[model samples]
Target: MNTNGLKVLLIDDTVMILQRLQSLLAEVKQVSRTESATSAEEALVLMDGYQPDVMVLDINMPGMGGIEMLRKLNVKQMIKPVVIMLTNNTFAGYRDECMRLGADYFLDKSRDFLMIPSIVEKVQERNVLQF
Candidate 1:
């Protein structure tokens, strides 16, 4: 199933990780728009203008973490974007908490990025309004 140009937002504190992920996502034809934010505030600001179909976010950061951002965005109840939690920490609690906070998937960045495609495919299959 093709996602057909789904908008994507990726938020991470690391500059290198953000760039690498953006490049990887860009390789997918269905990913038309891929935006990156180094902070939760920046991501939130971007969201105000562009409503993405799915968001791949980091769980840990300086000010507001992934869970905090997700919770806040959800409170608005405007766009229910599927969240794929990206984290270096693979602790059970972290995974459980992310799932509890409405993460569609959890990815460990310390490992190779093999599951991203599948995660995106799953999200597309589940929530793509045009699919």
Candidate 2:
């Protein structure tokens, strides 16, 4: 893992949202690589090849939602990536469930989308400091 750069994986069913996030993260100096998956299954497959330092996941999708994916990750005890749940779901239940399931951060897609880059940058800075 490169402490200087963040390998970010974005999971969102909406192509526009994915593109927007990719474009936003591109401006951040700490982000070296970015990948997008429209589904949890696709994200899992992508993870096999590219282990991301941070993951931006959406709660609603065709199959295996973000919360369920977090549960699976917890059960498998996989490479414990820093998970940031970015979803349009505004329910407190969803937010609480995601946090309980191991989400490092939860943000509403409609209101907090712009915060992603700053959060990723902070995560990168923290990673660098840890070393």
Candidate 3:
């Protein structure tokens, strides 16, 4: 993948997590832009202007949770970006629900956070190969 300028949107309520993710994503060769939102509502608003190629989302938020957001996105047919649900919630139900709702990938924030960038890189490579 020529990851020269990939636009990535990260949605997480924790400021520290967001900052960490932003820094990690910045190091990826394919990542060019990184945007963040504290909640699903804020992410929705940001989406109007920034159509990210990839979205790293959290399952829990103040207003709309990641599952609800994914359902809404599916209903509206807004599934262009590869949605990766990154959350601390590791319940089977939550994982199953997210996958059914159109999340391309689901990762536990504590255990799988470090794997995100590599996953994104692989996704980018797959996308490039598809073309």
- Per-residue lDDT of 1-131 in model 3, one digit per residue for the tens? 44366789999999999999999987898887889999999998888788888999999999899899888777764547889999888999999999998898989988889998998898789878988
Assess candidate 2 and give its lDDT: 0.90
Tell me, by TM-score, which candidate is best: 2
lDDT of each: 0.81, 0.90, 0.88
Error of 2 at 82 (Å): 1.3
lDDT for 41 in candidate 1 is 87
lDDT of 1 at 61: 96
On TM-score, the stronger of 2 and 3 is 2
**Could you report the Cα RMSD, in angstroms, for every candidate shown?**
2.7, 2.0, 2.0
Show model 2 residue runs off by greater than 4 Å. Answer: 1-4
Q: Which of the predicted structures, 1 or 3, would earn the higher lDDT when compared with the native?
A: 3
What TM-score should be assigned to candidate 2?
0.94
Error of 1 at 22 (Å): 1.2
Clashing pairs in 2: none
The candidate that wins on lDDT is 2
Which digits, one per residue and each the tens of the lDDT, describe model 1 over residues 1-131?
34456788989999998888877876676676888899998999998787888888998999999889978876875767888888888899988988887887888887736677666666666655654
Worst 10 residues of 3 by lDDT: 71-80
